[model samples]
Target: MKLLRNILFTSTLLMSAFAAGTAANADPGRFMDMKKSVKAPIGHKQFCQDNGWACPRESYDPVVVQLNEELWQQLIAVNAEVNRRVKPMTDNDLFGKEEHWSYPVNGYGDCEEYVLEKQRVLMEAGWPKSALLITVAKDVQNSGHAVLTVRTDHGDMILDNQIEAVLPWYSTPYRYIKRQSASSPVAWTGIADTRVTTVSSVSR
Candidate 1:
């Protein structure tokens, strides 16, 4: 009877460990819960118009990259490299406008510009356009900001100019507003962030 009880206890411990591991890794590719489509930001709309070649309006299969050590390292490297390379300046300082979204012209740009460059570099490196999205959010200061969201098996990761480390979307301090649709670059989808009491407008 003692041996039998010991065996049962060992079996229970093994099962419990397996369950915990499964729970920890569950939904590795889980995506954000998004709400209805929203209007693209004015700055992004204008950006599409000015840089027609960069904006493609066709629907395609959205991709979620399978994340691995190599891919995660790449994300870290790219995020750090860009954050180090670009000097941050407000849109008014760079373009003499309240809001302007474009690539950094002379190694200087605003938040959105850093997002643009990162998107460009990733896309050029063969990352699908569908997996890379331009996201708008309210920063810790409740001011508008932009960041690049990368869809992956490990969930949505954020690459930001203000932050040196690439982080999972939920770990960021910003209140997500909206982002480019995964199906089409021209479309936008609203993020259902419970933290947001009001759907405030974003300028970046």
Candidate 2:
């Protein structure tokens, strides 16, 4: 009887925690929208060639900024899945070379694959392609890194492999560089008008 009581108590606490998290998880009004500059990193073409990943031929209309409980739920679900499923690996370890970007065909892939998969899944799930962008940023080590940026009415929230939680762009630790333009997915665009020197990564 005592053990049963303990288990019930723990379950209650867990539910309470989840409720609090859901309530506090997404509050767009607290964040003011800001612009960040971007530039395409070198070797993208060669990287695409090496990995057999096709570059997007064209762009699409940006997803209308619609932020509600459902959109936020979708964002949270996708971000959590990608973060958990894709193992972190460098291009060198995975491909014996650098900048080898591709979608995750197997269970493991690099950072770029994480972004690609997230973009693909969200699109398949009926999210607008334009709102989903494969973004490259400079990490804490100044190394080039990739993430999927989801544009919404609240702001641009980052969906990253290194982090499980979806956060506003300004909350991340990396410096925003270049991202795929919503109007043209194949073409890159700058994140202009802002500088993000440090954004805290959820995990190392």
Q: Model 1: per-residue lDDT, tens digit, 1-204? A: 453344335434543544422222232223566889999999999999999999977899999997766676777787888888889899888899999899987999989889999999888888899999999998767789899999987678889987676766655566788999999999999987654444466754
Q: State the TM-score for model 1.
A: 0.82
lDDT of 2: 0.66
**List of clashing residue pairs for candidate 1:** none
Each candidate structure's TM-score, on Cα atoms with residue i matched to residue i, is: 0.82, 0.71
Alpha-carbon shift of residue 167 in model 2 (angstroms):
0.3
Give one digit per residue, the lDDT tens place, for model 2 in 1-204: 453344335434543544422222243232233344344455455555554434556656667557777677788898899878888777788878766777774678888878888988998898888788788777766677888888876567778887676766655566666677778655667653134424432211
lDDT for 111 (candidate 1):
91
